[model samples]
Structures are given as C-alpha cells and as structure tokens.
Target: MEDPARLAALETLRAVRQRDAYANLVLPQMLRDRRITGRDAALATKLTYGSARAQGLLDAVIEACSDRPLSEVDGSALDALRLGTYQLLRTRIPSHAAVASTVDLVRAELGSGIAGFVNAVLRRVAEQDEAAWVDELAPDPDTDPVGNLAFTHAHPRWIAQAFAEALGSRGEPLKLALEADDARPAVHLVARPGEVSADELAAIVGGDVAPYSPYGVHLETGAGDPGDLEPVRERLANVQDEGSQLCALALTRASLEGTDDRWLDLCAGPGGKAALLAALVGLEGGELIAVEKAPHRAELVRKLTSGLPVTVEVTDGRETGFVEGAFDRVLVDAPCTGLGALRRRPEARWRRQPADVGQLTTLQRELLTEALRLVRPGGVVAYVVCSPHLSETVGVVADVARRTGAEQLDTRTLFPEVPDLGDGPHVQLWPHLHGTDAMFCAVLRRPV
Candidate 1:
C-alpha cells in the first residue's frame, strides 16, 4: 500500500509544477486543510521543500539512470523518483525502507509496472556513497559548462558568484551564506508591544530573548504548535523572523521620534510589518494606513490587525489617491528581488535571475516616488527593500531623490541602537555580516 506521506509529497510536487506555488506557502495550507499534524506534516514539509530546493541536482541524478530525458518522463513518475533519490542520497533513512516506500507510492499512482522503473533508478543512485554522488553531481571547476554546473553545494554558478562578490574579500562568509541556505532556519517570533513584552512572550514560548531588540524572540525549538500555545493565540505574538522585525523596528525608531503622529506602510501585504507597526501605532496613539494592492493580501492585512487600530486599504501604493503631505511618516517597503530572504524561501535561488533585479528597480523607483509624494514635507520616508542589489537599493533612491527633491538622512544616527549599524547615509544589513536578511533601509526627507 502507498504510504500517506508519499501521497502528500506527490501532491506537493503536482501543485508546485502546475500552480507555480511555493512549497512553503502551499504545503502548510494543504496540511492544515487535511488536518495532518505533528510528524506527518513535518515530514511532508521537508520532502516538498527539500526536493524543490534540490530539483536541479535531483534531475541530474535521475537523468544519469534513465535512457530518456527527464522532460520526457511522466511528471508523477519523475517526482516519485526524486523522493526516493532524496531519501537514498541526502537523508539518513535506511535505503531499503526508502526504496520500498517510494516504489509502493509509484505503483499506487502510476501502476505496478512503473514501480520497477522507480526501484531500478533508486537502487543505482543508492549504490554510491554520499561523497561519490556529490562528486558525480559536482562539475569540473576548470571547464566552462561543467564548471558552471557545480552541484557539490547545489546552487547555480551565477548565484554562487554573486554571493562571493557581495561578501568581497571574506570567502568564508560567502560559503557560510550558501550553507545557511541549505540549513533549516530557526522559528522567530515578534511580541506585540503592549499586548506582551519580549521577555514575557519568550518565557511563554520557551525561547531565548533576542539579543538585538526588545520586541524580538528567537525560539530555539518548539515551532511545531503555535496554536497550542495560548500566548500566541492571544494576538500578543506572531511567527516572524527577528531580522524582519529588526528592519521594521529600525524604521519606526528612525522616524517615530519628535512626534510623527501618523504612519503609512506602502506596499504592505501579508502584513508582517503592518502587524508590528499597528501595535506601535496603538502605543503612540497615532493613526496608521496599510495600503496593499491585491484584495486577498489586503484582507490578510486586515485579518492580522483585526482588533488593532490600524486601517487596511486595498489600493496601489503608487496611486492610492491620498493627499500629498498627508502622513507624517511612511514606510515604502518596496517589492524587489527578494534576495535577502532567500534562506527562508528555499526554491527562490532557482526562480530568481539577474534580469529580475533590473525589472524590480523600475518598480522600486515608482514606489519610492509615490511614498515620498504622500509624506508631509518634513516627515520621514523610509525606503526599504528586502534585497541588497545596488540597483534596487542605491540606484532607486538616488534616481527618486534627484527628481523628488528628497534629501538623505544620517542612517547611522537614526538606527544607532542596532549594534554594528554604524552611522551612514543609508543602512544596508548583510546576510553574512548581521546573520540577518540583507535588508536595506534608507531614510529620506522631503524639504519643507
């Protein structure tokens, strides 16, 4: 009989292939919808994300055994083979059990006859040890295409080169960045300011207090059951990365001083920052407007701030039709190539390209211009991007500043509380340096 886990894995693969949906985004909802929890859900999540992240490497492995090209293979059969190969080569599971379980799954989905094919391909792949398989996948570093297809680390050559360039002179950090992408990320949480303190929430979740910020907590373990934990359900806490919380916090800290009574979060969607901002705004007795483009995402923002004072509006950040100089402060969390949060979004490296950055820079400039237009003359506009690309970060701001008459503020002075965040024209946090997402925050002001 086919195992339920294998059925879940095959379903995840089907969804990813057909819908272009992210494994992380799709799997959780599926699991919840099916009422699968604990170990089953965890296993399904692992198989889906792991296979997606290692798709290129898995394809190479599958290609070596099959006479026909991978594209020619039936999608279901190929995915079954991938699940088998992942267990045999990458995981610590027993080889026989892995092969047997996968073959059973193939028989159930495809046919009894197809099981033989899966068994043959998986056996060949399993015969080799991990090191040998890695060598097989790894390309010759000296050659052109082979050199470009180095699979020892499983990241594309262009991405690896970009990491090296961004980390400059520090070769170890670049390697670590690649390794971090492969490793399981920690579950982080943000404490809503008045609803709960970081210390109190940390005690509830059994997490250690986050080192950098008062409102952040890094849970060492116990991410499995946020619902069971009463503190989380009370809306006093949320599952969010400390790094993201820090970026949002840094923005409020930079501009919230000297009484910017009203706040705006342009391009707020799925509302993680908006949640934190709503709490902060409530504390200050200020008004907040979270403008999101999509109806579903705007509804999500509203759901996140259900009982809170923040207002969620379904509208474009570029042309929300708000009066000029209406808000005292605005956060233009412009959408760009999400290079900074790649570690969390495992399959992102494969999906992203150099061309995407150039395209995003155009959108970033437009968003920044609109954000600045809405801010009161002396009010602050903190232009933020969850990416470190020069074009998206510096270039967008530079171009917008030239046209809008906006002046850059001392970023270092504004976020002096963040350690190693020295005084500068803008703040660019690095994955290698801060052990956080590569978020860029540039605080600019319109001349009165």
Candidate 2:
C-alpha cells in the first residue's frame, strides 16, 4: 500500500492540476475521505501545500534532472516527480527514504514503467540540496532579478515584478515580501463586534491578539479546523485576515461630518468584510446592504451576516440600483486578482496570468464608480482590494477620483497605529511588514 499521507498529498496535487481545484479546499475533503487523521493529516497538509506552492521551482528542477524535456513527461508521472522532488528538497526526509517512498507511491498509482522513470529523475533531484539546485537552475539575480526571485521564491516572474514595482526601491524589502508570499499564513479570527472581544476569543482559542487589528486573533498553525471552535461556530467570530479587519475598521473609524447610519458592501460575496462592516454598523444603530452578484455567494453572505443588521442582495454591484447618495458609507471591496493573499491560496499564483489584470481592473473601476454613486456627500467610500498591484490599488482609486470628482482622504490617519505605511492618502498593507494580507484601501468622499 502507498504511504497514506504522501498518497493523499499526491492525489490532492493531481486534483489541483487536473481539475483546477483549490488545494486548501480539496486537501481537507480528500483527507477526510481517506480517514487520514492526527500527525498523518498534518503531514499530508504540509506535503500538499508545500508541493503546490513550490510547483514552479519543482518543475524547473525536474526538467533539469529528467532525460526528456518536461513536455514529454506524462501528466501523472510529472505530478509524482513534483511530489518526490518537493519531499527531497523541501522536507527533512532523508534522500533514500524520500526516493524509496516516492517510488512506492508512483508504482502504486502509475505502474512500474512510470515509477522507474520517476525513481531515476528523483534520484538525480535528491543529489542536490535545495539551495544548490536553486543556484544551478535559477536565472541570474543581477540580470534577471524578477525571474530569479520568482523561481527562488516559487512565484511567477510577473508577480515578483508586481511586488517589486509596488515596493519601488528594492533589495531586502522586495526579497522579504517575495519570501513572505511563499510562507504559510497564520489563521486570523475576527471577534465580531457586539458578539465577542478579541481578548475573549484569543483566550478561548489559545491564540495571540493580532498586533494591528483590535478584533483579530492569530492562531498557531495546526490549531485544527476553526469552524469547530464554539465562537466561530456560533458566529461570534470568524476567520478573517487582520488586514481585512483593519480595512473594515478604517472605513468606520474615518471621521465624517454626516449622519453615518446606512452602509453598503458593494461586492460582499464570501462575506468576510461585509460581516465585519455589518457588525460595526449594527453597533452604531445602522443597517448595511450587502450586494453579491452570484446567488450562491449571496446565500453565503446571508449566512455570514445572519442576526446582524445586514440585508444581503443578489445583484451585480455595477447595477445595484440603490438610490443615489443614499448610503452614509460604501465599501467597494472589488474583485481583484487576489495577488495579495498568495500564502492562503498557494495555487493561485500559478493560475492567474497578467491578462487577468486588465479585465479585473475594468470591473474594479465600475464597482468604485457605483460605490461613489451610492455614497451621499460627506459620506466615506472605502475602496478596498486584497491586492497591492498598483493598477488594482492606487490606479483604480486615482481613476475613480478623477472621473467622479471625489476627494481622496488621507487613509494613513485612520491606521495611525500601523508603522512604515509609506506615503499614503491610500494605505497598502504587506504580509512581510504587517503580518497581514497585502490589502489596499483608499478613502474617498463625494463633494457635498
């Protein structure tokens, strides 16, 4: 029989590659189906995520080791090779054990012929330490810094360029940001206002208080499924990034001169920000309208904001049809490339392409335009995205401000506690800097 943990990881990788499934979503279900539990489950999770996150680098290494070009390798055989290479280079497993066990797994899944090929390639792979292989295979950092950083850090070159561009002057800061994208992100829980305090939730869950977000707690890895926690199960707190919590809080914290009661979450699907916003509005004796275009996601929004002063609407944010100047606050947490949260969604870097940006920025502009329309004069519109790509962050904000004649408020003042915020009427949070997702926010107000 195949080693269950390794087998589970291989199967999860296959699902991600073949079916376009999300590793984080597919791995848990695969483990449960296979009855993989305890230390074995943890091992499976690590192997799966580590292998998926390092696919680009692993493939480069495999191409170097294989007799034939990577294109000639069969899909199943390629996945097995990737799995074995990841274990050899990334894990502490001895080369002999990593090779022998991977050979066994390949034989069980893909037959002796492919197993022989997998064994030969992986043996060559095991001969080099990870850094040695990286040095041998990675593009020169001096001439091709973007490509070098991409391979070394397991991101696409475009993504590395995006981060570097966002960082401006580079060296350590750019390197640190790229490295952080590859690291596993800690789970962050938001203690919903009027439901639970961050301290109470942290105590209950044995997590530390998040450094920046008043309502957030950071859980240690392998803290088990957060859904099982009573606070989360009861809707008192839910999984949310500290950056997202801060973005929602910033909207409410920004000083405004008008009646601040009605709120609109323009793209509130999968509802994390909407739930946080709803809880805040509820405390102020206000109501929130959460608009999600997809029916399924709208249902999710409904469940997430249940018992809060929020109404979930299934309508396109670009055409929400809300009365002009009706909302005291509008949140355009627009659909973005999700470049910011790579650690949480390990497979996304490989999935998204540069072309995705053009379409998304178009949608982002539309959503921001609609948000501007909904906010009354003197009311605030928080344009937020889980990305720091200048096009998606500042570009969208700048375009909307120019077109709509909205005043860009200095967003830095709202998060006075956060350090190294850079020059910002718009706030850009980084995973390396703030231990949070690279969420971007710009506060704007229409002329009264």
Candidate 3:
C-alpha cells in the first residue's frame, strides 16, 4: 500500500505536467478535498512545490542516471523519478524509502514494464553523492555563465540572466535572489483597519507591532495556524504581503487630505489590497468601490472582507463607465507578468515566458488610459504592479502620463521607510533591497 500523501503529491505533479495547471493553484484544493492535514499536508506541499521549482536540477540528475533521453521516458515515470530525486537532493526523507516509494508510484501508474527501469535509475541516483551530481550538472562558469547559474541554481537560463542584468553588481545578489526563491515564504497578514489594530493582531501572530496604518506584523517564532488565531477568523484580519499592505497604505497617505470621497480600485481581484483599502477608506467614512472583471473573483473579494465596508462589483475596470472625474482616488493595481512573486508561486518561474510580458503590458496600458477618467481633478491615481519589470512598471506609467496630463508625485512622500523606494516621481522596490515583495508604484495627481 502507498502513502496517500505521496500518491497525492505524484498526482498533483502529473496534473501540472499534463493539464498545464499550476501546482500552487491545484495542490491546496487537492489537499483539502482529501483532508490531508498537519505534517502530511505540509510535506505534500513541499513535495509538489519543491519538485516543480527544482525540476531542472532534478532533470539533470535523472538524465545522468538514464541511458535514454528524458523525453523518451514515460511521463509518469519521469515525474516519479523527479519526485524521488527531489527528495534525495532537496529533502530529508530517508533515501531508500524515497526511492522505493517513488518506484512503487511509477509501477502503479505506468505498469510493471518500467518499474525495474525506475528502480535502476533511482538507485544509481541515490548511489552517488548530491555534491558529485551537482558538479556533473553544473556548467563550466567560465564558458557558460548563464547556463551554469541556471543549472546550479535551478533557474531558467533567461531568468538567471534577467536577474543578473537587473542587479548589475553581479557579486552575489543574483545568487541571493535565487536562494530566497527556494525558501518557504513567510506568512504575511493584514489587519482590517476598522475592526482590528496592528497591535491586537500582532499579539495573535507574535509579530512586531506598529500603530498607524493598522497594518504591521513580523512573526519570528511560531507563526502558527492562521485559522486557529482569533483575529483572522473573526474577519478582523486577512492574509496579505507586507509590501501589498504598504502599497495600500501609501495610497491612503498620498490621497488628497481633508476630503470625504469615493475611491475606485480599478483592477481589484483576489482582493487583498482592495479589502485593506476598503477598511481604511471606510474607517475614514469614505467609499471604496472595487471593480473586478470576473464574477467569481468579485465574490471572493466580497467574502474576503465580508464585514468590512466595501462595495464589490463584477465589471471590467478598463471599460467600466468612469463617472468623469467622479472619484477622489483610483488605484489601478493592474495585471502584469507576475515575475516578482516567483518565491510564492513556484510554477510561475517556469510558466511565464518573455512573450507574456508583452501581452500584459498592453492590458496594463489600456487600464491606465481608462483610469485617468475615473479620478477627479486634483485627485490621485496610484498605478501599481507586483512586478518591477521595466516595460510593465515604468514604461506603461510613463506612456500614460505622457499621453494624459497626470503629473507624477514623489513616491517617497508616501513610503519614506522604504530605502530603494528611491527619490523619484515613482517607486520600485526590489526583493534584494527590501525584504518586501518586488513592487512598483507610481502616484499621478490629476491637476486641480
């Protein structure tokens, strides 16, 4: 009999390979449906996400052991080998059990014809030390720096070069970024402004406390179960990145002071920021209307901040009839290539291609063009992305600002604590510079 957790893990990887599904998206639901819990749930998540993230390295190890090309191997066997190799290289599971269980999984899935092949290959893989295998896989640094970095660090070659070019120093920043991607992401939470203060929620999460903004926490030890925590389930808190919380807070700080107004979250969906903004604006006795294109996602936004003051609508922000100069502030947290969130979304690093950026930029520009009419004269419109890609971040904002008359405001005036937030009309935060998510924000004030 096979461990159900391991079987689920294998099945999840198969889904990712055959269906072009995302591991992060599929695994949570799978785990819930099966009622996998505690250590089993955690290990399942690790096996699924880690195997996906380190597939390139696992491929190298598998290829070294096999006589045939990886493409020639049965898909199920390949995934089984990858999962077994992932355990050996990336996890502390007992080596024999890892190999044996994976072989069993392969035999069960692909029939007995390939079981011996699976066993033989995985046995050879387990026989050699990981360091030796890594050396064999690592490209010569002098001859193929990009390939070397990609293979050794388990990154796509183009992505490795992108980070190298973006970092410029090249001394160690790229390696550090790659290392960060391998680590488990810290759980970040947001306190609903009207319902919970930062101090109250911080105590529950055992995180650092802060006063204003109603959004600060730095849980060190025992991050613990969020659901078991009181504030979160009570609708007084929600999970969100500190960077995203900062972005929403910056908008509130940069908004026109002394005005009771209507605000629009132009591209709100999976509504983390929209919910946080709603709490702030609502506490101030202002209206925050969030517009999401999909009805299902709009319903998620509604459920996420159920008790908070917010109006969720199912409509496309880009084409939604903007009451000419109707809103005091509008936040276009526009869609873009989600390159910045690689650490959180493991499959994203592989799933995204360079071409996706081009398509996303076009949508981003269209949304920005329409967002101009949504904000009132002398009001502010904050354009933000979870990415710091040049084309989507600065290029789109600059293009819209040039076409429209909106003037860029100093971003540091809003997030002074963020050092790389920089002294410019806009701000771009890097994961290397700030522990926060790589995000870009541009505040453009419509002339009064």
Candidate 4:
C-alpha cells in the first residue's frame, strides 16, 4: 500500500498551494477521514507542516536542481518533490526511502515520466544537507545580515524585517525571533472559566498548566486532535493560545468602576476570545455582545458560546449601530496580516506580504475607532491583534488614540507577572520569549 502519511501530506500541500487552504485546518480533517492515528498521523503532520514551513528554502534547492523553473513544474510533481526534499534534508527518514516512496507515489498518480523527474530532482536535493544548501543560497551576512538569517531560518525576508522592526533592533533579538518561527508550537487550551479549573483540566488531559494564563494548559505537541480531548468535547475547555487568553483577560483585569455589565467583542468570530470573555462576564452575571460580520463565523461564535451569555451579531463592527458609549468594556481583536502567529500557521509567513499590511492596518484602525465609540466613558477597550507588525499594533492604537483622545493605559501592567514585556502602554509577546503566539495588545479607555 502507498504510504498514507506521505500521501496525506502531499494532498494537504496541494490543497494549500491551489486553494489557499490552511494546512493546520486541512491536515487534521484529512487524518481523521483517513483514520491515520498515532505515528502515522504524527508523520503526516511533520511532513505537511515541515514542508510548508520550509517552502522558500526547499524551493531554492529544487530550482537549483531543476532544469525548469518551479512555475513550469507540474503542481503535483512539485508537491512530491517538496515532501521528498523535506524528509531528505530535515527529517531522519533515509534518502533512499524518501526518494523511492515519493517517486513511487508520483509514478502511481502521474506515470513513470513525472516520477522520473521527481526522482531526479530529489536525488540532487539529497546530495547536500539543509545546512550546506542554506550556506550556498543564503546572502552574505556582512552586507545583508537580516536576509542571511532569514534564509537560514526559512522565513521570508520581509517577515524577518517586520520582526526586527517590532523589536526595535536588528541584532540578536531578531535572530531569536526568527528562530522561534521555526519551532512548532504546542497546542494551548483555555479552561472554561466557570466550568473547569486549569488544574483539573491539566490533570484530565495530562498536559501542563501554562505559566502565565491562570486558565491555560499546554498539551504535548503532536498529542493527537485536541478537539477530541474530553474537556474540549464536553465544552469544559477549548483550544486557545495563552497569549490570546492573556489579552482577553487583560480586558477583565483592567480596573473598572461603576457599572460593569455590558461588554462587546467588536470583531469576535471563531470565538476563542469571545468564549473566554463570555465565561468571565457570565461569572459576574454580565452579558457579552460578539459582533462578527461573516455569517458563518458568527454562527461559530454562537455555537462556541452556546451556554455562555453571549449574543452573536452579524454586522460590520465599524457600524454596529448599537447605542454609542453603551458598553462597559470592549475588545477590538482586529484582523491584520497575522504575522505574529506564523509559528502556529507554518505557511503564513510565505503567504503574507508587506503590501497586505496597509489594507489590514486601515481596517484595524477603523475597528479600534469603533470600539472606542462603543465603549462608555471610563470603560477600557483592549485592542488586540495576532500580529506584532507596528502598523497593526501600536500604529493603529496610537493613531486612534490621537484622533479620539482615548487614554492609552500601561498595557504591560495588565498582564501581571508576564516577564520581558518591554516599555509600557502596549505589550508585544514573542514566541521565543513567552512561548506563545506573538500577540500584540494595547489597552485604551474612552475619556470621561
């Protein structure tokens, strides 16, 4: 029989390449449908994500070996080459098996002609290890330090530049940040606030409690589908990154006086933060309004927050048409370039462009502005984005603050005991530093 893992990985790559499907989203369903459990499932994940993560590096090697440009290569053949090359260079899988299996699969699907081509390219790829290939392809560090390191770490140069700029340095800090991008992040789970304690949830799932978030758990990487976990299945806990939990918790942590009943999640969809916020507000008998413009995602929010006191509204957040200054606390978890969470979404670094930033930043600014308008005077609004890009993080917050005269609180203080959160008023969490997605949060309060 054909190797199920490699076949699954190849198909997943094809889906990602052709349809812009998320590997993380597509792979799990494929594994389930194929009944690829345990070692097979793990291998499929490693192959799929590893190949996606190292696309740039592998493409460089393939183009070096190929007589034709990658654009000229058949998509299916290209997928097989990537799978074979990732195994040959990165994984411990032997070169003979990697090449033979990939060629065999290609042969079965596309005949001996394409298989011969895949075999030829991959055999050339196996001639040198990843390090040797990187050394040959990477730019000289003396003149292009960032580009050199970015290539070495298998990241797009623009992403590395964004990381350096966000850190306010292009030195060791940039190197550490880029290195963090290459590590596979463990799945993080958020224990339902009123339903399960973090300790109990950790014990139930055999995972470690997250260091920072009181209700967060870190499951072992490749520990199978977290969606199948009992707490998750039972709705006692749900998958959410610790950094995201901290950002949601920050809205609750920020001191509020007088009425604290009404809260709004201006852009809540797929509802990770909304669920947590709902659970917290439910503890206080308060209600949460989760406004999601996409109907399908809004339904997701409704489903996730079923028992919690959350009302999902399908409308553009910039014009929710709700009463102005009606909410006591608000969360503008605005969508952006998604540069911060690249470690979790391996293909994202390749997909996002610097040009995508301007459009996203404009939307982010509008969302924050709307959040400020919806928040009552003296209420706090946590402006959160799963991006460390300055234009999407502090730029939007600062610009909106200037325009609306919203008070920028020291956001660092809100995330108590979370170390290495640099200079105040805004928090940028790094994967290497925080072992969390590089989530950015800025706390703003409408002036009384």
lDDT of each: 0.77, 0.90, 0.79, 0.92
Best by TM-score: 4
Model 1 TM-score? 0.90
Candidate 2, residue 278: how far the Cα is off, in Å: 0.9
lDDT of 4 at 269: 93
lDDT of 3 by residue, 1-448 (tens): 8487788888889998999988877887887788887878778888888888888888989998999999899888888888899898878898999988988888777888899999999889988766788778798877876667677778777777766665563447777766665566666778777666788788766777632234866554224345556777777787777777777777778857546468889888998898888887887788788999999999888988676678887888877875788888889999887767777777677788888888999999999878887787888888899886778888898999999988998887898566655557787766666666677888888877
TM of each candidate vs. truth: 0.90, 0.98, 0.91, 0.99
Model 4: per-residue Cα lDDT at residue 309: 95
Which whole-number lDDT from 0 to 100 does residue 118 have in model 1?
85
Candidate structures ordered by lDDT, highest first: 4, 2, 3, 1
Pairs that clash in candidate 1: 412-423
- For each predicted model, how many residue pairs clash, with residues at least 3 apart or on different chains? 1, 0, 1, 0
After TM-score superposition, the amount by which residue 228's alpha carbon in candidate 3 deviates from its true location, in angstroms, is 5.9
- Where does candidate 2 stray beyond 4 Å? none
The true-versus-predicted C-alpha distance at residue 211 of model 4, in Å, is 0.2
Off by over 4 Å in 4: none
Writing each residue's lDDT as its tens digit, candidate 4 over 1-448 gives: 6699999999999999999999999999999998989899999999999999999989999999999999999999998899899999899998899999999999999999998999899989989999999889999988999999899899999889888899998889889988988978899999999888999999999999999999999999888889999899889999999999999999999999899989999999999999999999999999999999999999999999999999899999999899999999999999888888888898998998788999888888888998898899999999999988888887888889999999999999999999999987799999989999999999988999
Q: Candidate 1: RMSD over Cα atoms? A: 2.8
Candidate 2 per-residue lDDT over residues 1-448, each given as its tens digit: 5588988898899999899999999988887788888888888888889998999999999999999999999988888888899989999988999899888988887899999999999989988999999899999989987788888999998998999989994477888998998988899999998878999999999999999899999999876667768999989999999999999888998888858889999999999999999888898899999999999999999999999999988999999778999999999899999999999998899999999999999999999998889899889999999998999999998998999999999999988689989988899999999999999999998888
Task: Name the TM-score of candidate 2.
Answer: 0.98
